[model samples]
Target: MHQALLVPEVLLEIFAYLSIISYTQTTSTQKLLAALARTCKIFHEPAMYLLWTEIHGLEPLLGCVTRLHPLIYHSGTWWDDSDEPWTKGVEPLSAHEAHQFLRHSSRIRTLNIKSEHPHLLSVIPAEACVFPRLKSLSLSTTYLNLFLPHMLHRCHLLSVDEGLQSFVTRCIALEHLCIYTPHDVHGTANELISDRIHWCTRVVTLSCPILD
Candidate 1:
């Protein structure tokens, strides 16, 4: 049975089935994929790739870096530099760790960040956190300004707020865009969309309601 499962075509089919099941069932997918990865050396790469493709939040991704036991900085007496430090919680990823994190992060194709935590966005350095394969992004209005620019260069689909007109111009490969214009800003949505129509050459689907 083990020898039969080692065939390349059979392994690909098995991995594909696991990917479909993982997408359809969100709650248990992570655990199941992690377990599958540990089952055998052959299953590890594909299972891990699927596990990191569609990340829902920053915690798990950050967990990977933290688990590597990277160095952490702490606040100390300004005058003495040698005084006992007192800062708590994990510090930002060191330069080396940031590089390692980015290597793994490059596999992510879809990222959905719904949490409102301000610090969550700071965990990874903006300049170093480029997701080369990221195609889909869902961000709250608050985080749009902070994270959009760093990711827009590669993202194909985006869900963001109306205030993104300035940033949308930078999305070269954006194919689908959904902007949630608030009531106060209803009148400007159309104008903004019209003015920026040529910003993203590949945009085929836009969902910004024009308020009358």
Candidate 2:
């Protein structure tokens, strides 16, 4: 092995570059990191850290809880209908499973959930802050109630209202928020959001949908 590769900083920079390049390639960055993670113990932590730094969906995080394996497999098709039977008969995570879930969840810095998956609500650990190091989040309205308790620095929201209020009051670290409402916001809803925004001075950047 090369001497420079022995240095953690050098390895991280090299891996970081690989992550950027993979964005334009057919191969994903996570695949490359996953390979490095399995290569040796020295490469494992950094590789896994970068791999879990930013995640597109909750499945990868939820997969850590061994009890949820069966539930996650159905997630690909589960987003279509909230009333689906798949959400039924589900079990909550055991204390040990919740600890396992937190181990990986703590690594996620950015999380984006495109659609709502109700099963997560039933399976998520009751921890107050699942993603302790999370800095950015992108979520559908369906997820607002599920994830609002976690603090974040930046957020992108698909729907708005009480969810918006939760973010304002609970996410004291929040500096940026972008909201896109599928339907135009009107009446008291507009005033309520505006008032909340006025009270939360920590937010430096905010983009809200056109008010009616």
Candidate 3:
């Protein structure tokens, strides 16, 4: 190992650059970071941190579990080359497997969940404060009931359904909320506007596409 690699700042800068480069070369960057993580003990923490700090979906975190099987390509759904493969499992997750999942889950600050997989939520261990440091979350209404327990600072909702008020009320720490509804110009839900007014006083920002 080089002396420069021994410096915390230097290692962070290197990993940070790789994180940025991941924007255009995601797979390559991930492979490089994974290699760095396995290179040595000192490189492990920062390398893993850079790899897991921000994620687009739940697949990466769930991938840590050995028992869960990926169901994306086999489900008849088109698997996008750019995204992580979706997974589903019915086997019981062992304590060690759950620990591995949580180890990476704790590092995530931003999460964007697209499709709903009830099995995804089912695999999580009970009474666990998953994503303890999570700050921003983007998820659809199908995921609405799953992440309400987190102390999120920002939330973006897509494909919103009924019960908007009840959902917003539970996010006590939410500072910003963006709701995207499928309703058109003349079909905006009255309950949505009322709920926004009700929550506007507490939350710093309440954004809705229809209102704009």
Best model number under TM-score: 2
lDDT tens digits, residue span 74-182, model 3: 4534444355634433544566766766767767778888755555466564434577777888887665655554477888887666645544566678788887765
Question: lDDT, candidate 3, residue 154?
Answer: 86
Better of 1 and 2 by TM-score: 2
How many clashes in each structure? 0, 0, 0
Sort by TM-score, top down from the best? 2, 3, 1
**Model 2: clashing residue pairs?**
none
List TM-scores for all candidates, in order.
0.63, 0.78, 0.71
C-alpha lDDT score of every prediction, in listed order = 0.57, 0.72, 0.68
Q: Which digits, one per residue and each the tens of the lDDT, describe model 2 over residues 1-212?
A: 88998898888888999867887899878779999999998899889888899888766766776777667665444333344544456666566776776677777888988644555455563335667788898987566655654468898877666656676557877889887765656887777777777766788998887533
Better of 1 and 3 by lDDT: 3
Alpha carbon deviation, residue 201, candidate 1 (Å): 2.2
Worst 10 residues of 3 by lDDT: 69-78
